[model samples]
Target: MIEKELPLFPLNLVAYPGEELNLHIFEPRYRQLITECVNNNTTFGVPSYVLSKIEYGTEVRIVKLEKTYDDGRMDVRTVGMGIFKVLDFVSPWPGKLYAGGTVEMIKADHDGDVVLQEELFKLANDLFEWLGMEGLVKFDQKMLTYAIAHKIGLSKEQEYELLKTTSEKKRQEFLINYLKLTIPIVKQMEQAKDRIRQNGHFKHLDALDF
Candidate 1:
């Protein structure tokens, strides 16, 4: 297990690799954390904040610092580097107002089976059309999972499961199953709405030949 010390930023959302997340740094502790990371050109870990505890998170690099307020607050942009598991948590590191911990990096399968990739792409494309989203998205191993994750209506728990998954093949299988289950339900809801719309409508009758 590889271990490294990293600053921790806890949030209510899951950050996937290759995805962009915007943050507003107003809290004094977090402001200090961000300042240190920016000045030293270091990266931080964002753990999934759930039920008042940190469970899973990804390492992110600050790509842009949009603004800095008069009171030391900041607006910044970060992109997910990859996922990591916290090995140890430190509430207050020495000489700092923030928290940090040691984490182990998770390996991801970059070149999963090509056949599985094509199958998942088809399912994602079909689901997108069902929801009337314009334009199809391109899929590859690195981004295929994250790109369609939220779009496929997976709950936070499900998304976390995907995050914890280390292999691309397993992630693709999970996505395929989620899509297959959800698409039918969505179609049924549309049919129900159609039925309600046709209720109480007047119908024209043609004369019958005697």
Candidate 2:
């Protein structure tokens, strides 16, 4: 039932909660939008861009305004706050330079299946090892999905699908299946690379002592 008017920034990427997204602001409309947000201490929304339309988005608040260029462009550091679904869209809100929309907040569940989380963690670690990644980022029930979203190699559409899912358990299951399918394929690729690297190597010969 959470509804509010949020400034919408449509992009081809998905922002997950507890994740930091750095953005470059150049367009005049968005520059105005960012400036207003900074002045009013308000947050904005980045609706998921899919096939020339926006349906879902994450509400984000600027953590810091990193830089302001001479041409009025800027770089900002922002963090995602929550998932939202756009209920209505308005381009150029009245006299404003930016687009906005009424969005309904999608509640995320915290109580996911513990056993499933543990299993997924193991699979993720294994996949990381296969990919030659050192060390692991600790994951908890609260931010598990966001922490692993990028690590699982999900496509933009798949990540958006993950963002749309409201239930924690359902998201966990979805990621687990994705990892299950991807891990073996990555493993095969790694093995093939190893074989190619050994292509012209000499083998030790055993003496025939018959």
Candidate 3:
């Protein structure tokens, strides 16, 4: 439904659709890439570089070009439009300094199971509350994965796994499993931290009822 050969920006992190990532364009190739996208009002592909290969990426558009330095570098803000799978890589992009690639946009299902959505929020809120980030997630549209993907603790490979999965229910299941596994450990860590903080405090010990 969009351009097939989009400019490629391979980075160490994963880019999820509907998320905003601000980037500094210091490299010559990327500067050209950002400039061209701004001029054409086009979208580019941000394939995550994992294990030294490019497979999956997110399609993003330059919504705003915040600044252009005197030296020609730029600071631009981009929002991910959708996910994509690279079909082919074009190094130097046939007259471009940066890489370009043929990619097919992968559709993300926004609808999630209501029960699962609730559970995801419950668990997410627990983690956030413990971390003092209680209001971080706004869950709606049944897109619980989108709401929690970036915020929840997930490695780059784990994030890419989410991108590979197109089903909403499955993604929710994956996240649920993740949270169920993670919350206990986080709870233990928090408990240990509290104990550490209370190390020197004098406590009024009530008679222990065993």
Candidate 4:
């Protein structure tokens, strides 16, 4: 396992590998962190929030950084694709929120058969259509996968489960299962909405039968 000390950023949200996270760095410390990353060409770790503790986060590379203010604030967009295991942490100050930790990178093996990826994309597309989001068909397969995964309603724990897997084949399988469960729920919700509309309960009526 490749290990190194990394800066930890705990967010209220969970970001999966191959997902995009846009952050507004306004705090002085984080702004400093961002500046150091941009200047040094380094990446940072983002641990998933779990039951009041953050143990896993994806290592993200900064794709674009835009200066939004003269006071060291930035509008930065990053893509997360690397998983890291937290080894140790230190919170030097009590009130300070950020902490530093040692991390080991978890490299994923993408050597799986391409046929599996193709089939997964097909299933994902079908799920999107079933959810009445056929408009997403225009997006590239990778983007479509990411979009659907975001909509799967996985909790932070479930997302961390996906993040920790090192095999592409297993990740695809998990995602297929998630799509199976989520697509039906979305369809049921849509059916309920259709029922409510067909009943005309929300429409203005000319008169009511007495």
TM-score of each candidate structure, all chains considered together: 0.89, 0.93, 0.91, 0.79
**Tens digits of per-residue lDDT for model 1, 1-210:** 567889998888788998888999999999999988999999999998754678679999999999999988899999999888988888887778888989898877655667877888888877777777738555444456766676677888888888888887788899989888988887788778888998899867798999
User: Sorted on lDDT, highest at the top, how do the candidates line up?
Assistant: 2, 3, 1, 4
- RMSD of candidate 4 to the truth, in angstroms, is 5.4
Point out where model 4 deviates above 4 Å: 93-98, 113-119, 137-148, 200-210
- Model 1 alpha-carbon drift over 4 Å, by segment: 136-142, 204-210
lDDT winner between candidates 1 and 2: 2
lDDT of 2 by residue, 59-175 (tens): 999999999999999999999999999999999887888999899999987578888888888888888889988386555544577778876689998998999898888988999
Clashes of each: 0, 0, 0, 1
Clash pairs, candidate 2, are none
Candidates in order have lDDT scores of 0.84, 0.89, 0.85, 0.73
Worst 10 residues of 2 by lDDT: 134-143
Cα misplacement distance, residue 180 of candidate 1 (Å): 0.5
* Residue pairs with clashing backbones, model 3: none
TM-score, model 1 to reference:
0.89
TM-score of 3: 0.91
Best by TM-score: 2
Candidate 2 or 4, higher lDDT? 2
Q: State the local distance difference test value for candidate 1.
A: 0.84
